[model samples]
Target: MRNCWFATPGIARPMSIRCWSSRWRRMPMASDRKLTAFFLGFAARHKWRFLLSVLAMPIYAYLVAEAPNVMRRAIDDGIMAGDRAATIRHSLVYLGCMVGGALGLVAQHWFMQSGGIRTLTHMREAVMRHILGLGRAEYDKRPLGVYVSRSTSDVEAIGETMTAGLTNLIADTLLIVFIFVNMVAIDRKLGLMTLVIVPVVVVVVDIFRRILRPLYDRIRTVNGTLTSQINEVLGMHGVIRSFHLQGAFNRLFREDNDEYRDTNIKAVSYDAAVFSILEGLSFVAIGGVLLYIAVRATGTEKALQLGAVVAFIQWLQMLFPPLKQMGARFAILQSALAAVSKLETVMQIPLPVDEGTKSPENLNLTVRDLTFAYNKEQPVLKNVALEVPAGKSLAVVGPTGSGKSTLIRLIVRQFDLNPGGGEILLGGTDLREILREDLRKKIVLIPQEPSIFEETVRYNISLDRPEVTMERIESICRKIRAHDFIQHLPHGYDTVIAGEGANLSMGQRQLIAMARALATDAQILIFDEATANIDTETERLIQEALDYVMATRTTILIAHRLSTIRDADQILVLNHGEIMERGTHDALMTRPGLYRRMYELQRHAIPDQ
Candidate 1:
């Protein structure tokens, strides 16, 4: 089979057929291709508006070009000849051209802005949808703030480029073209003399672009890093303070902040230097035009007419502002291109492949020769095999890093197993053959550290499920013995929990997590050290709740405390990724194996409850 690969910013590897498979791969750096492809695709979606914008540009250019000609006629045929009527007629024509040019400009701006906005909106929506579709494993690999930066600042830059930068760029290019055409139309020799500055300006702008591209890339990278650091610090503020590492975090943040500031300064300095050079070049071009006009007027028998000279000067003036402003416009273009590259890189991440068509009808669980490794070299679960009948509780006990949590992760498809390593079955159907959503609905894992959103208790319990009514929620809470404490809260089910349930005690958070699990009404429940973090008092409160929740469902409990698993239907002792012993409470005690030894050690380590 062909290996599947997805790319993010740093890592690159073929996606393995595991539960936590990557869908994205690194896209090659093809800035030009990415930019051109995006605009072309955007234009196809808004064809009429884009075409209309293009059409208005030449018309606007023509109207603008007509103004200088009318002025030349008024000065030569009317004013110099002492004919007021001719002057008035030419002046009226100039006014009419100016008005028409102004209207055309409005139309151009409207069409371009409209098309750009629509295109960017669609792009933003598509990026957001892709981000949402990414698996938990992707989020685990990248900082939340990096993704936020991509969605906000980076996206805004691209939008600005498409709308304002693009509009002005097109308008200026057309204006320059028409101005050059008219300058030559009036006096070919003089126009050619003036056009000599065009190449000089083009070369300068090109030099600036080459110098600034890498600087802007640096700015964007630093900004993203700074944002990521800030987000991480804020998210873990509690831990940082508890450990008294505030000073360390401050130093780290200061370094990142300073780096961001310095990069931006460098980019701005380059922009300023380019702007100053272009402005100086503009003046030089104007002076050269004047020198040419002075020589032609003084040395020739039939001197250049005053009217033609003035009109040509006006055209020359119009030409240089666009060239002068080109540096700033190019800066925007570069930033936007960088944003596009980033967006394309993210969009290439592959979504999870959900090809399973089977759904389990019962909750009987079986694991056969299940082996896994994070690095493929050192196996974590080595040929593990176990079975749990429907509605039976299985307790898994092991020392730390002995594949206890790894086994649970494999069953939940957190990471994919190697082909031929093993197979897991639910209700006699292969686990890989069951749809993810269907599998999740049937089995729920209440982790040791449950995530509680900053929302009402009701919302957290229901998890936005519209069908989970208040009565059902309260009933579940009551069964889990969480209702009394919830009722004592300020708003009962409506009470809003703080971030990660910081306002609630450890036991309260675990109880809420239990309530959530029970709310799902899943057929199988896996408790991965759910009561490990709480105090003895909290564990007592939770044990009552756990007994009721595990009574009907098939349960998988991972516990260090032997007391917690005393009533378990079966206990499997694991050590170094292999099953060391297996039996019930009495049978395991008689064996004098890993389980019996562990039980005796814990019993002696602490007094019985």
Candidate 2:
């Protein structure tokens, strides 16, 4: 009766991912138990309907076998015995069973679909939560394409396995088994003769199927590639126009399109061959069964009765459809398996930073002998050390790729992984020792590419916090220059934004992001190159928000434009993962270092700076 499914390929859930502890602990990896259990749990709640449906199966099977018996009674007990009334009665009884079977079949199909969809919804929600709960580092390592497929196509493939697959498998398997059992029971020799064709059919079908599968898979891959081409071209339409490379882009598109067509045609040809072969073999086998039955049948009366013979023929015809359908769905099954493999690989990658189990109690912030690199061979930051006094602002300046943003990420615990490393401490508290929930409240990172969800601006900025007042929102928006745009629009603050705030400009989006960070109201704030994309008009407004943000919080400001951070309590110059210099901005500009050079260049780039 457990409501949890623990069948993740090979990955352990993050401790934070456990919504239910007892059920979570029972997760079983590397076994179908979790998968089977998931189904049982889904079916158990609605078991009464399922049980009723299952009961219908035997009735279906019995009626099927009974129809032949009725024909036998009509011929032997009625016609041969000279009882015409019995013949009519048996005929009517046979018709009634068929009608009942048809009704039961409808209910049975409905039940399977209902169960499949219910399971699909549950799994979709859980996977969505798991993806959402995954820390930033995991998201960075994977592509948007992968997550998109996981949620849509991949999950759908698995859902097919749950619903359509479940329905077909249950009906085919049970029906096939029922036929086999009854067939052998009635006449062992004839049944044995009919089964002679099974092994040959199975072997031939499997061989052709296996040969065709790879080509089908290639067709899928090529189609996805074509889709990728379209996405890339459309997403970068502005860039393409700027470069004046429409012809070149067209050429690339043609090549991908051609490849897709070629692969698709090849798969189609192979699939045609498989079905054609199945067709030829189907008649051969069925005809041979009839030959054997005809040879073994006794005097016309003693031989397999006409009714049994008709039912037997019907059974033979029924078998081919299930067999062919199972083959057709093989691709879906394979796709689900491959998706599981990819999902497993991702879940196995260790998250960059593992939050420890210790409690966080201090407000003191310090960095000591910090070292980090994107790769092992070349260090981006080396032997660096710095400190931020509680509630003070520290600015970091560096050239592009000089590791300034990396420094801020380390401080705010953005990576969540360990290989490319450094350590950050606050109030004698190692950042990793703090719980993630606590860390979110205490430390916040506002990235340059801030995300804007497709929702009302109020919902996007206020983040469902009931305490956020209209006055507070208006104040922050004004400070970030978003107030002008918000008020100018017809709907103002209540207007909804879609397509990731495509209705607004890039600068407008960043300002709204600033509002989001401000709303978090964390104790520590780090902004990594956040103001770079804002317009000159909005830059000053964002700076006002920054001023308010740093007044009573420990702040780490990363800047290429030095003017924004000149008033910072301390400025650290970072180079090659090392702290080359640290001092007040005015003092460092006079000292002949990277800070002075960056200041002069930025003053030219932005006259105000």
Candidate 3:
């Protein structure tokens, strides 16, 4: 029957719901232990708040439990005896209990919510730090949306458990226990009879829980995928529009969205079913107690009094709400646990290794027997060798996918090399032996596409670096020939850049990247086709800047435009990750080699402009 019911939506993967339930039972206990430790860490940080919340629960429960008994005393001793004073006394006691209980509830919630905010803030910071620390390879394993979802939505889910679900679970349990004890104290036989439905309610809750656990997991998983799809689509909206792929992306998004909706509907169906059964059973318990009173009260020897009956009725009313709330809170707890598991997986990605402690003393660069591949079977670069003496320049030219970028990544230590693959050295120190922080300060890569932030031009150029003052920034901009254009902006260097440099021309954006690179005053400068996207006039200005900047700096220039590298001290014509030819521009062009062919082709293509 469970299998048939779960089959209606057909969302569960790998197996039917029955199979999933059986497998879930066999899941290892270690995961539960890990999750327990996860919550324990949360408690350890905010122990006082959690303790206060727990301590207030029993106080609130006791007051709530005694309220109905107070009403019973008023009914039997005052209303039945026609004494207004007794009724007024009991009424006053009831009011006091209500006020006291409200305060306890308020205290419990306030402490829990405040603690949750602090915990959530710390948790988000940890996740962001982890994401930033991840290696370039780890980032390739998942989409940006997955990280965003985990950091934002998943963290919030766990926060909800801390604030509302866990707090309510404890409070409701205490409330139920106190209500049961008071009922039994009033009339043991009636109290025992009312509980006949408890076993059935437990069974129903268990079955629905099994049904919803996997469903909730599915819903959360689909939400992440849907979010990733949305981010990808939005981030590539221009490309999609250029390729007329709106309909294709729309269909893909619809599929993920529909799957999300279907899983949620299944979860809601089972959730509603649980609540319906709980409500029905509550009514049954009440009706059974009333019937028992009627049957037993007919005798001359009364089995129950009117006061007890009234109190019992009132207690039943109080009991079922918490009963119903337990069901809702359980759903929230389950969702939180699912989020915990997802976040745990993300946090387990290996952090980048940065144990290098040595610093280089010079800018001389050397690559020896350099070989690499994203995977073992398909090598991108093999047995590559190159060198650039301090204060000298080297130019690398190759067709796309000839491992030009791979070589650059290797030189910058973006990917760690295998033991026998290759070695890159700066001065006499191996690249792997140099501290990453120090290495970043000395080596900078300016790519064809510039990254501009939504800040003033001054911030974009200086990047808030302490060393790059306003004077230094102006000097660098002037060297890069960008000072004049920047001064013409509405606010000069203080003008705020639009997102992705929408307000700036392609040439202007590239010029800003150049100015930033120049301001660094680094020993070695790497320009990877920096002028590829700029106009001819901007390229000319950038070339002039490059001449000045490269004169004293050890530079690695990777370019497609052969004319730009004509004056490079040594030019290497790279093909298929190997140095096919190496010589000065005039020497290489004089021979019938790859460099001469490429130079001639570009020279003819440009039409002497």
Model 2 regions more than 4 Å off = 1-59, 79-82, 184-189, 255-305, 326-364, 373-379, 416-423, 604-609
In the range 314-383, model 2's lDDT, one tens digit per residue, is: 5666556555544434444444455444444444455445446555676567877777765667766787
Which prediction has the highest lDDT against the true structure?
3
The C-alpha TM-scores of every prediction are 0.84, 0.82, 0.86
- After superposing candidate 3 on the true structure, give the runs of residues whose Cα lies further than 4 Å from its correct spot: 1-29, 82-86, 199-285, 300-303
Query: lDDT (CA) for every model shown?
Result: 0.79, 0.67, 0.80
Pairwise TM-score winner, candidates 2 and 3 = 3
Q: For residue 596, what is the lDDT in candidate 1?
A: 81
lDDT of 1 by residue, 533-601 (tens): 877787788888889877968899999788788888999988999998888989988886888888888
Q: Could you give candidate 3's per-residue lDDT for residues 1-609 as a string of tens digits?
A: 133231212112121232222123232345977975765675578878878888888888889888989988888888887899998999899899888887888888888888888878877887889999998778978999899989998898788777867877788799889888998888887777667656676677668777777886677578778887888988999999999999999998899899988887777788668667777787887888888788777866566767888889888877766654455566567667777777777888889889899999787898899888888877888888888998889999988888887888878877888679989999889998999988888998887788999999999999999989999999888877899999999999999999999999987998898788778867788888876777677778778878877786888889878888888999988888788999899899889999999988988898754
Alpha carbon lDDT at 233, candidate 1: 85
TM-score of 1: 0.84
